[model samples]
Target: MANNQNAELLDKARLLRHDIRDGSFTGYTSGLVPGLVQGNVVILPKVWAEDFLLYCYLNPVSCPLISMSKPGDAMVPALGADIDIRTDIPQYNVFKDGELVEQVTDIEQYWSDDMVSFVLGCSFSFEEALLRAGLSIRNIDLDRNVSMFETNIATAPSAKFFGNTVVTMRPFKPADAIRAIQITTRLPKAHGAPIHIGMPNKIGIEDLAKPEYGDSVPVNDDEIPVFWACGVTPQVAIRNAKPPLCITHVPGKMLVTDKLNDELAVL
Candidate 1:
């Protein structure tokens, strides 16, 4: 019965993803599709892909590569059977000369033969694991996107890609933070473990109430801020690289995949 319930939930989530892809849905997919794997999307010219792939390889904690598509190919068979790169995401950020120029729900008008698509593991996958362990996610409870920041930690450089890492923060009591680290450690694809716990200023963040990206959620007086390596780190690298054209999903929006969260477990 438990398995059946999960299956039903997966079906519902899959349909939601499809609706978003087809232009019927245009909302953040935070807790709507529970138990399904969500991914960060990056599309770049083939000329830039090699360095980007290497960057991901060098910084596995922040950008764990889940799947990549052949240049000009719109489908990622490993993620979902009908996943179309140009239309599968709820929102896209169009960057020109390292700055965001526009936001769109579909990219078919911008698709090109020289483009390559990348799907990176998102922290949402591990949120399912955390919930299974009976830990609460503050952002989910508050109906907001997870708070993310630009950390002082720099990623290992790879050719044109070099920038500071970006991270998402979730507050938990000290005991819950430790358990979150252990639970997330089992899912390396979704950013393994917390990079910093307790001290936000030590990581160069000025205030917990203000975030570099996504919505801010409150932290209780007794809870400590726990930081995880976020997939958004690649966007900072893209900006640094300054490619002629770069595309990525908007901060909270992501590509919902067919792969099960358990399939990504390391142990």
Candidate 2:
């Protein structure tokens, strides 16, 4: 029975990837594909890939490395059998000289022999675990992207890759927030634990409603905002690194992989 359920989930993920590839589903993938691992993407030239690799190593909590592709190789079979880094993601941000130049559904035009793609562990990979723990995820419940912000907290730098950490926020009552912390701690590959519990201002986020990326959700008066180190941190790094060319998934629209969330959990 468990095997049959897993097969069904895998089929769902493949279908979703097909829709993304065909430009049929160009939106955030937060609540969709429960139990499957989702990823954050960064595609760059071979010259810049090494530095970015070092950067991810330095900031493992914020930029946990998952599967990476060979230069000019658009396929990341380790993440999913049919993933084409250039087209499988719903949306992509094209950057030139550290500035965002365009947002597109497919990056086939930018493909080159020197381009390397990196897939990083996303917090969404652990949201299923949170749900299993009976935690109500506000963004998912509201059918919105998770709220993300650029914080004052700086990430450990490597070469030219340096920037403040970006984080995802979800508000919860105090007790539930504690439970969330415990539940998420078991998934270090998916950004293990909360970096900050409350007081958004303390982390340089002035307004919870005005996040730097993704959409904002309501926080009730009784709930406190909980912040987790986000996979989007690499975007800020890309801006600072000034790579001549870089391609990344738009903040909330992620690469849905066939890997199960439980496969990444620690005991």
Candidate 3:
């Protein structure tokens, strides 16, 4: 029975990846494919890969490294079977010299032998745990993208990579917010626990309605906004590092993997 269930989940992942690859599902991956692991992607030339890797090492909460591919290798078997970095994600953000050049559905044309791919754990991996704990996630409940913002918090610098942290926000009542902290604390790879519970302005976020990335969800009067260190922090660093070329998953859109979210939990 367990084997059947695993097979079913793997099938779901493959189907979703298929839709993403073919451009049928070009939207945020927040609430879809529950129970699977999703990732934020970063592709950089070999020359800049080491610095970015070190950056991830310096800031584990915001950029938890999951699986990295060999230079020129587009496949990440550790994350999922036959997972091709070039075409699996829903959307790609092309950056050239610290600026966003374009957004595309795939990176096949830009992919090359000198490039390396890195997959970082995403908070979407933990939303299932929150739901199971009987908590309501406003963004997920509304089928909208989670709100993300650039914060006043500075990340540890490494080589050319240095920037303020980016974070994702979810609204919950004070009591449910505490339970969310307890639930997510077990999944560090998925950015465990809340970094800040309220006061968006305290974190350099002036207005909750206006976000740096992803869609903004409504915050209820009785609820406070809970923030989690986001995987998209690398994109901010990529801008500061000013690499000649870089590729990342579009904010809110992610690379879905066959690995189960349960695998990332600790205790």
Candidate 4:
């Protein structure tokens, strides 16, 4: 990280976070704030927060807990000094009784004194790592959100939080797939490595062209689809648990943080 480059990355992250907090930028955060970490937002009441924490512990690959806010607190000082969880996320999925009630850009109206915000590491951080390694990620190149789908693979259950895992797919040549695995394995907090590779049908995914979330990108005949455990997995579990009130970032719209992606990689 050169001094100039680091400064530029920090500037971009700051500007983007400001836009998000101000309710101006409300869209997919993929490819934005290139070298910084972006997280999946999940806000739950104190009564349900402990159970959700246990869920993250059980399904680390999909729900890797990064920075969690103190109960009844809206600020995550660990991720960023000025982050306000209530309004930092670009978009939120408001769920009631396991069903989505509405999608909103800001969650200030839903904020509660008992609410606890949990920030989970997202694949966007690792995508930048991949790009830096010279691997071509189709979704990023095409300016589209990574393709995500529900898998038959079930996540480890904890109390009321239990459901099948959800995964994001990126097509790659054999060599690139191998390199991606090597590179991503170091970032355990960012979902680690691909849960399944090559065979979508083997994992109960019926169609690649039609994904459950995000837009579909081309997967050439010679390319294999590489799947990574996604943060959205918890959203499904949250819905299953059907808490009285639940909120999560709409898929692809993340909460930008000041932490660098490289800082999260493990040897």
Candidate 2 — which residues are off by over 4 angstroms?
Answer: none
Please, what are the lDDT tens digits per residue for candidate 4 over residues 126-161? 999999999998998999999999999999888999
Off by over 4 Å in 4: none
Error of model 1, residue 21, in angstroms: 2.1
Regions more than 4 Å wrong, model 3: none
Q: Could you tell me every candidate's TM-score relative to the true structure?
A: 0.97, 0.98, 0.98, 0.98
Candidate 1 lDDT by residue in tens digits, 158-244: 998999989999999999999999999988999999888888999889999999999898989999999999999999998998898
- Which candidate number has the best lDDT? 3
The root-mean-square deviation over C-alpha atoms between each candidate and the true structure, in angstroms, is 1.2, 0.8, 0.8, 1.0
Model 1 residue 114 lDDT? 89
Clashing pairs in 2: none
Weakest 10 consecutive residues of candidate 2 by summed lDDT = 76-85
189-258, model 3: which lDDT tens digit per residue?
9998889989989999999999998888999899999999999999999999999999999999999999
Q: Which should have the higher TM-score, number 1 or number 3?
A: 3
lDDT at position 141, candidate 1: 91
